[model samples]
Target: MYIEQLKNKKYSLGSYIPIPLGFILLMFFNFLMSDGVDTNEVIQQTISMIGVNLTFVVLVGPLAFGLLLVLFWVKFVQGQTLRSLTTSRAKVDWKRIFFSFFLWGTITTAMILVLYYTQPENFVWNFKPEKFFIFLILAIILVPMQTSFEEYLFRAHMMQGIGLATNSRLIPLIVTSVLFGLMHIANPEVGKIGYIIMVYYIGTGFFLGIMTLMDEGLELALGFHAANNLVGALLLTADWTAFQTNSIFKDLSEPSAGFDVLTPVFVIFPILLFIFSKVYNWKNWKEKLTGKLIVTNEIDTVANDSKL
Candidate 1:
């Protein structure tokens, strides 16, 4: 039983409790530290919010709220080694990450290209070499923080918590996937594209969740996500997109949902999944994913004694 694995594996719930709470406190600290304590400081508020999120990403490992929580669970709670936390003791698969990064990157770039070709005048072609290079450097440093923060929160902390709580794979998968989508509701893209685009956002969560659950570790998901955001932030920028930092290209093209929108959700995602499944030789996914976690007395007995 998967739940039994939690106990037999010495997994504990205490580690999960503080991470989300700590994140909330960190966010409050960010809000309090922001400049101008007024009703309408939009720019300041935005900067502070981004700052808080990125800070959380950087601290996740050190603070045990993000990737750190996963490490804590494997190391202290489960008494497992570091290799278990990172790769589930399996070989790191670089091809999976590369295939996903390029595949998704090309799909997004193609959409921008089509839009640009159709409406050249709409796009300013504002490529300033110096500014764009500066943006690239910032992205190399910060976007990983952003993507890692979200992944650690959703896939690492929340996924593990729900998996332990419900003692079933399906509930955690659904809960984390939905929560991950909700977390992105505040991004500027949502307003421009309307709530309909949430299907894509939430769908991406589901896809990532499937990857995590199937892989039994965050390595592939981490690589894929880091690559996705890093490439996107560096490759193009649009007026409507959030994080309007300098990039190699400014998307002068108007954004709209087309086959481009559906390709990732409907096509690329499934292909990536198939690719991973084959590479990992993932078997009995239904069992590995949806099976119940049966908590046993063996590990819990010792865990309970530790409290005394």
Candidate 2:
């Protein structure tokens, strides 16, 4: 029944036609906003970029996306249900959320510790009580917003629309994952690692997409992303990192796009993925990822034909 419902809401060819155009519009607006900002140096400019990301996060709700799909259904095709729009019918599983949160938090903490061991000098013993508390508070409020916006856009909104349109799991999974990576092209890490880092970003997208599809909801992705960002922002701050917000430990290390990007992509993420797969008992990987999307006429038929 859920699969049938998913099929009913799939988008048409014209459904995502606006996505790229929308990005272009958003970029233009961001450039205009940045024109007069007070960022003078490279570090300042990077902070300014973070500010831009924050602005986008504020504009887009934690689950703001999928509206495009709803619009497509209403304007292009007829008979989309409210459940499809609100995702109310598919219950949000909190257990998945907590599990993802714990899993990512542990993995990320381990990664940070490993990094610290390799380059202790890069970290300035910055465990000041006052600053640490401030970082904690900000994480409590803002970090989740940033992570949620990303998950909602790429993992939730875009994935749902494309899934419905293609009537298949794999196409949407691949497309949304790549787009998610592409969106990060301007990240500071990109400049450091060349395009090779994109593999990691896209890989992460694939990982989250799989979690969402198999789990039958966005709770896992949402929780994982939120926990990842929240911890990253609160636990550490580096001059070279994308988010330089007040953090507990300031990384003074010269930032290079080396093992940092690759390790997470290659080692940490895969381990986490395996852990999740085992914990959730996710099966039929090939089928769930590559399966075709099908939109049934049953729901619509029942509603309309009932009147006859």
Candidate 3:
């Protein structure tokens, strides 16, 4: 029914197709037009010249604006509400959003602390009081826009659009997950670690998709994503990483897609899902993940809108 709600919206595979294409075109055009910012250029000099805080905004701003454009289209053109885009519940669940945020935020931060202490030599305390404060303000405001854009595009819009088009839960789940990973193929991590790290990216997609589907909403996924990026931006900055920010510490280790990356995908994600299932009491594993998406014609008389 959550997926079926898209039927009432101005949503079709065709309609949804152009959003990402336009986003990609806009990014390319911006890249070409922006002076002295080269995607292919040396990473350190660019960061030094551009300033870490400004560079962080430049990398993330387009996706954030693109998400705004999509939200506008969803509201005006599609005649759909943000609550509908977010969840099947009566309204957006802010509790679920922050719950998932702090839950994963704790786990992620703890892991980073362990790594930091275990290999202190690999991390440089890059905290400049003034610079970090500025970076903090920008990261708090802008990082969510970046993470939310990905979640909305992949888990909210594309997941629903692809499900409606294919009329199957499994296909959309897989397609959107893989496509989400593919979207990050150009990230600096890919260049540093090679395509071998795609396993981590694609695995992350699968985790988010599973969370979105099983939770029957994007709240959990949104929180998890925001926490993941937000914590990373605040705790660590790396030359080869995407969010090259003036965070508390800078990673100087050689980047690799070894156990640190693979274990999370194969082990930690499943553990987190299991914990979520227990807490949320999620059942119907087989049906929910791979079931047919039947359109429900439930009418919400109070809101004067139809629900699926």
Candidate 4:
């Protein structure tokens, strides 16, 4: 039903191409141009030059613009309401968003604390009140924009686009999940921990995609993502990570692509999915995720006039 919201004739492939294609090309070129350069060194140098907060703005600000772009395209080009782009419900569900955010935020913070207590030597107290508060403000403001841009692009927009074209939920789920993973190929984590980290990234995409399909809304995905990035930014910073922020702690451990990488995808994510499924009362696994989409004429008309 969420994907069927895009079944209107106004939702043309040409309309969908430019924004996502431009984003993918930008990432590809950034990866290509940074091929031989030491990305960590570059990040360090940039942080040194501009400080952590400004460097974060430099890195993440465009994604806010990207979020605006996606919303604009959905409204003007596709002639759809923001609600339709986000969910099939009568309105956007703020309660679901907040629930998912609080749930994941607590889990992530607890996990970080467990690690901090378990391996005290690997972490340093790097919390500077002045710098941290500044970074916190920026993280609170910009991090959601960055995460929301990704969710809207990969989970909502591209997922619906691919589903509209193929009429099969499984194809879009797999394609978007893989594309979402490949989009992060240039992250410093990949360079630090090797390509095996891709399993986590791709698996995260699958997790989020499955969540979107099962929940029939982006609220859970959006909230979970925002909380994950925001909490990570506030709590920890590592040289090998993408967001090397002025956080409460700094990781000094050697990066490894070991059990940590596999655990999330293989263990924790399935558990989280189970929790979300139970909380949301999700059903019809065979149809919501992998079955053929059947959009009646009435659904198409309603989708078309959603802007009215």
Candidate 5:
């Protein structure tokens, strides 16, 4: 139903090519340009030059603008309402969003605390009150923009577009999930921990894609993502991580592509999916996720003939 909303005269799959093509080209160029450079040193130098807060703005601001641009394209170019783009319900569900945000936010914070206590030596107090409060304000505003941009692009825009083209939920899910993972190939974590970290990134894409399809809305995915990034920004920082903010603690441990990278995808995501399925009462698993699309007219005819 959510994907079917894209079935309209104004919606041309061709018009949407430029957005993703541009994104792919950007990532490809970044990989080429940073091929031999010491990316960690580059990140550190940039942070040192501009300070952490400004560096954060420089990194996140464009994605925030990107979120706006995507919305504008959907609204003006595609002639789709923001509500239709977001969900199939009569209106956007703020409660679901808040519930998901609070749930994941709690889990993430608790996990960080457990790690901090278990391996106290690996972490150091990195909080600076003056710098932190400012960073917090900026993060609270900009982090959601960055996260929302990803969600809308992968989960909503591309997912719906691919579903419209292929007429199969499974195809869009797999395609978007893999593309979403590739989108993060240039992240510093990939360099620090090796390509194995891509399992987490791509798995995260699958997790979010499954959420969108199952829930039939982006509220949960949006909330989960925003909380994941926002809470992490406020709670932890690592030199090897993408967001090197003045958080409450800094990780000094050596980064590795180990079981930890796989645990979230293999263990935690499945558990969360179970919890969400129970909470949302999702049904029709084989149909909702893997079924072929039936357009409105066909559905009407089927119902009419069944009654006859």
Candidate 6:
């Protein structure tokens, strides 16, 4: 039913081309700018002048770019509603958003505590009253915008568009997931932990993708991603992490592929999936994930045949 909405003439597969075309235009501008001045230098210069806590604000840049383009294309070009882009439900469910946010936030905070207590030597208290509050304020305000951009773009916008283009659920799921993961290749974590970190990134993409498909919406994915980044920025800090903010604690140890990384990918993610499936009353193990979307004339044909 979610994918079936693509049958609207305005959302026809042909209109999907503008989504990538817009992104390419944005990328071209980014590249042209990069040729003249080192973007990293500009960032570092800004950080040196504005203090490192504002780095989170700086990090929101690319997400902002992606968000603007997607919003314009979806709203103007495709003439789509935000509710349709986000969910099968008639409205955007704020309750579901906060529920998944707190659920994953609690789980993530618990996991962080487990690691800190079990490996006390690997962490240090990094709290500074002034700096942390500033970081918290900035993170609270700006971080959702960052996470929202990613979820809406990769999970909602691209996922739905690609699904329409391919006329199959499976290809879009896999494509968006891979793109989501590969998009993170520039993250500092990848450099610190190597490609093995991709397991977590790609696995996260899969987790989010499955949740989207099973739930018939992006609300859960939105909350989960917001919590994943927001809580991490608030509770933890590390030099190797993308968000090297002033957090309550700093990870002193080097980045590595370990239970912390693998457990979520292989263990906890599956458990969460099972829980979500039970709660959402999702049926059809094979069809929803891989079935061909039967919108357009197929429904008309069925209706006509039933008249006999």
Best by TM-score: 4
lDDT of 4: 0.87
- Per-candidate RMSD vs. true structure? 8.1, 7.3, 4.4, 3.7, 4.5, 5.6
Q: What lDDT would each prediction earn against the true structure?
A: 0.62, 0.62, 0.80, 0.87, 0.85, 0.78
| Candidate with more favorable, higher TM-score: 3 or 5 | 5
Listed in order, each prediction's TM-score against the native is: 0.71, 0.74, 0.89, 0.94, 0.93, 0.86
- Please write out the lDDT profile of model 4 over residues 1-308, one tens digit for every residue: 68886665566777777887888899899989989887888999999898888989998999877899999989887887888778877778788889889999999999989989999999999999999998888888999999999999999889988888889999999999999999889888888898999999999999999999888889889999999999989999998888999999999998766665898899988999898887777788889899998777665222211220
Which portions of model 2 show Cα errors greater than 4 Å? Answer: 1-4, 9-21, 28-90, 255-258, 294-308
Q: After superposition, how far is residue 36 of candidate 4 from its true place, in Å?
A: 1.4
- lDDT, candidate 5, 11-105, per-residue tens: 77886677777877887888888887767778899998999999889888999899999999888887778987888666777887888899999
For model 6, state the Cα shift of residue 87 in Å: 0.3
Backbone clashes in model 3:
0
Predicted structure 3, TM vs. truth: 0.89
Give residue 198's lDDT in candidate 1 (0 to 100).
77
Instruction: Write model 2 residue lDDT over 1-308, tens digit each, in one string.
Output: 22335553444546444654576467566546544442224555544666533432443333244344434544455444433432323444566677778878887788788878897887866576775675566557666666666675566556666766666778878988887787666555555556688887898898888777765566678789888887777667765455665555678765545566676777777777787676667677777677775455554321111100
Give the per-residue Cα lDDT of candidate 3 at 201: 89
What lDDT does model 1 reach? 0.62
Please give the distance, in angstroms, between residue 303's alpha carbon in candidate 6 and its true position after superposition: 20
**What's the best-to-worst order under TM-score?**
4, 5, 3, 6, 2, 1
